[model samples]
Target: MGRYACVVRPSISLVVPVFNEEENLAHAVAVAGRALAEFTSQYEVILVDDASTDRTPEIIRGLTATDPHIRTLRHDRNQKLGGTLRDGFAAASMDLVLYMDADLPFDPREIGRAISAMEVTRADMIAAYRYDRTGEGLRRAIYSYVYNGIIGVLFGWPHRDINFAFKLMRREILEAVELRSEGSLISAELITKTKNLGFTVQQIGLDYFPRTRGRSTLSSLGVIGKIFRELIVLYPEMRHPRRRSPQPAVRPAEDRAPI
Candidate 1:
């Protein structure tokens, strides 16, 4: 008698980094959860709370209590967006890992499209670009154009939306690259590193929506300056190639606060 082998379907881990987004948390999770469910039943949503001073933590506790697939990871102190993302990536446990903003600017359902693209083309990473970016001022627009241009010229990869929040990548790519940025520049760092490592990459378009509940945290001039400074420091590393390292172990959700 021949024995049958179990074929494992691809699973996904959705990482959402939350900071003082109490107003949007419940709705974001609901929408994103429904979107993920449409694609694969084997998935997990990891919410990383960066020590929000508001009622964000309490809201997360309430949401996680009802859903076993929803897990919460808390930072004792507030870390910036980059730190929160690093933790989220480390906590992800599925074959594919995706991270997006908590404000839900892009349609969550697009995640299914991204996963399909990844599978069809066998690409290692899928970078999302916004078609009509709403709710952004002229200053932000100019800054984004200039920043993306600089990255293109420096890295020789002309990806227009380097800082957009929707990124879906294979687990092996994350394991092979080393990420150091702990600010807004983390997005750029991840892309640059992936390109450097010769990973297959593809781009997809997403429709942007205006945020209704919370304001962006990285709009301050100080934050922008820090991102530029980090980019300057990362130039030398990007120019040189290093041996790919083994994938780091997925860190179990730390400070698993009782819901």
Candidate 2:
């Protein structure tokens, strides 16, 4: 028998949140689909449109018309990153769920390696950090450094890139963790709660690719203020999350790799 003939590939739900990404949506989805096929045949690409005011809706319709594996959900109004991902996670019917941004921050081909890491380490969630981020610019780099430091101090997890939009997890983790943040803090909330609730999270390092086609407003002062306001309102709950229903036994997190 072959060395890997018995390995079972898990089904996946690739959740992508988009706003005004008409230029990148179609191409990104196509690339993701191809990459996903390299590992598993059973996968769905869920495109969550957060009330985009562009040709995004038309593009989604065209994609669904041609690809049966592609699915979409749209909001009546802008709900930001948290709400969009919440809906996508709810609609996902797979054993595993992976979240990526519309701009394609990392190579989709890396998806295979992440899955391999999860299987090898028996990790409940896989969080990816960039090997290098200097291409994104100085202001964002400073923001990332400070934000990561604060999260490390408060959460005590020492996660390298809490806000980076590259995370993969088993479906059960999302089912057990109730996420409430409606802004960028959602990522931090997800990672923090998972760590506190006794699930194993493993980190991987990947090459960073900054957005080249569209403008990124995630680093704007307005967004930063909203994240802070949310942090204040949701601090207590995040610090001490109420455990949901019991989950299956998880292995000790001692095997997790360093980023």
Alpha carbon lDDT at 26, candidate 1: 91
Give per-candidate clash totals.
0, 0
Query: Highest lDDT: which candidate?
Result: 2
lDDT of 2: 0.85
lDDT of each: 0.80, 0.85
Clashing pairs in 2: none
lDDT of 1 by residue, 30-86 (tens): 998887776664889999999999999989999999888898899998778788888
TM-score of each: 0.89, 0.92
How well is each residue in 1-259 modelled by candidate 2, as lDDT tens digits? 1232225677889999999998899999999998887776499999999999989999999999999999999998999888998899889888789999999999888888888888877888999999899998888899999999998998766889998888999877787788888988999988888877877899999888999987796888978888899999888888886666575443335542221
Give candidate 1's whole-model lDDT: 0.80
- How many angstroms is residue 151 displaced in model 1 relative to the true structure, after the best TM-score fit? 0.7
